[model samples]
Target chain A: MPEKTVTDERLLELLASEFTFEQGFALLVSAYKQRLYWHIRRIVITHEDADDALQNTFVKVYKGIAHFEGKSKLFTWMYRIATNEALSLVQQRSKHAAGTLDGNNSAALLKADPWFEGNETQLLLLNAIAGLPEKQRLVFNLRYYDEMPYEEISELLGTSVGALKASFHHAAKKIEQSIRAI
Target chain B: MSKNTGQELEELSPLLRQMREKGDGLEVPHDYFDDFDKNLKQRLTERGVRRHALRQIPVAVKRRIWPGLLVIAASLALVLGAVRHFNTGNEPAELAVLELSADDITAYITENAADFEPEQLAVLEETPDAGNQSPAPEAGKATPEKEEIPVEAVEEIIDEMTDEELAELF
Candidate 1:
């Protein structure tokens, strides 16, 4: 056991030692379990898939923890792993479900086009966001929905803040145009 | 350039202001995070199971892995056991004659039926236990295990040796 108090940071320090793999691993599971689950839940949008993806994420993290050289914070590393697992789950679920990877809500949008008739701004925003590539969609989601700063988005996506800012700018401009067109 | 701060900021920041003001996308339900946390904990548990199973195997045993590991394990147990027979350190002097010449081995088995059991000697003529990653086991069962036999002896006496003898000894 570590002589120091076992905060997450201190536990990380202990886990860095090969001698503390089990203790460190248990600590990791307990510490970030909830945060990771919620993060995955937002993307996959179903309890069953979220459950499966969450498990896969933890499994991946456990297998990959030793490879985590601590270049980033523990939560950031966990988030990255969770992100990959969630996106992969999304892709696989899309193949078997009514949704497609690129267009999960397209059918609903098409069907509800009449309902959103009064909400011209929403339609336009959707159009502009839909126009973006995958990476841009991710950047927009982090910046817009999560209200995250460029730095947090950068850490999560492993991109530079400068690049993320530029991406956000483009995304906003497109949304503006989409709304204007509506 | 001539515009006031209010007008400039309003026009430039229309999307940011309109996009639900950052903190207003959707208020999460009280149960939202709770369910997520439950699912996450369950996933962590499953991961623990897989990692625990991996940890149960000894490092040394996992090192020399092969496809036929279970069978190889059983055969190794029997072979090491037989090897321990001579290696016991307190054997009678006559029993220590496990290292005799081929002629002496056969003759001793033939003559000393009661004392020098031919069964033990016969094991010498049986096929090898089939070590992995070699061409030796390809020798048919009849070719005999001359793995312990000297290559010079095989070259001298057994010109009509089976493919197994040729493969194992030569």
Candidate 2:
């Protein structure tokens, strides 16, 4: 027999009710965990960090679900939280590596990470992407990799669509330059 | 594709275009998401238990506890007040000596000379008004005679007292 799939609206309604919150959250986690994990993994560049950020994102969603006004799609709100957690982890890693030999090379860390499975070309691409500034890298990843629309990206990031377009353009140019130099 | 992105991609070099097409090269272990979901559910359950514990204080328990809590709090406040009162009562002389400057002591003694023991009044009488100004004699009041100590001499006496001597006096 085919199991009934719950809609996001139904899930939100259940989550808002005290009796069904646990069941609603479990369903929510199962539905979105993979998408959210991949999104976080791309930003943080490590599976473990992504795992931590994913869990943190869900925990935040669970806690904040009651206050959710449903102004935006539930997934979009979760993606925003996941993005913040991933970026916060990256910022922490940058600060931790500031004085070390690693310096600001997130690509080097990604290469050394056992979970990273990129080939030489992919590594070069990653290295190029890593060299872009943080916002540009995010813009590029969301647009190019996730294939998210600029309007959606703008909503998640609170940046103007025009600004995101410019950022993605600059990010692509910089990645091209970096890849050519390599 | 958006008009802007289509134009941007058209302008990109073939290698750059291929890179963008190739996507971010990342992978996860087999059954990683399954394991992650299980662990997350476990954590959420734990969190739910904790949150439930915090908010599930029973109405009956709260009703019974409030008056007891209020009593404990009031008792604590009274104990604290009594301790403060006792401390202030026990340290009156020390606080008076430490807080009042020599001139203030002389003025206070002169104003209320009838209230003190003769020995306490004599201590004020011997310690000169270090400022060299005498309190004015009121028309109906008897002026306690002011003994003037040179300002330099008063400063020297204060400077000569060790911390131990000052503490002992207090």
Put down candidate 1 lDDT per residue, B92-144, tens digits, no spaces: 33333334445554454456445433544454456332222134555555644
Chain B TM-score (model 1 vs. true structure): 0.18
lDDT of 1 by residue, A1-182 (tens): 11223455555544556677667766666677666665665555445556677778777776665566556666778888887888897777667766654433632443343322324344345445545676887787666655566677788887997887778767777767656654
Task: Indicate the residue-level lDDT of B118 in model 1.
Answer: 58
Candidate number achieving the greatest lDDT relative to the actual structure: 2
- Residue lDDT tens for model 2, B48-148: 73321112333433454478789999999999999998887566343335444566545554765565567655554575555456556669987555444
lDDT of 1 at A92: 76
| TM value for model 2 | 0.60
Taken over the whole model, the C-alpha lDDT of each candidate is: 0.56, 0.70
Candidate 1 Cα outliers beyond 4 Å, as residue runs: A1-8, A14-42, A45-48, A97-99, A102-131, B1-12, B22-32, B35-38, B44-48, B52-170
Among the numbered candidates, top TM-score falls to 2
Q: Candidate 1: deviation at residue B76, Å?
A: 54
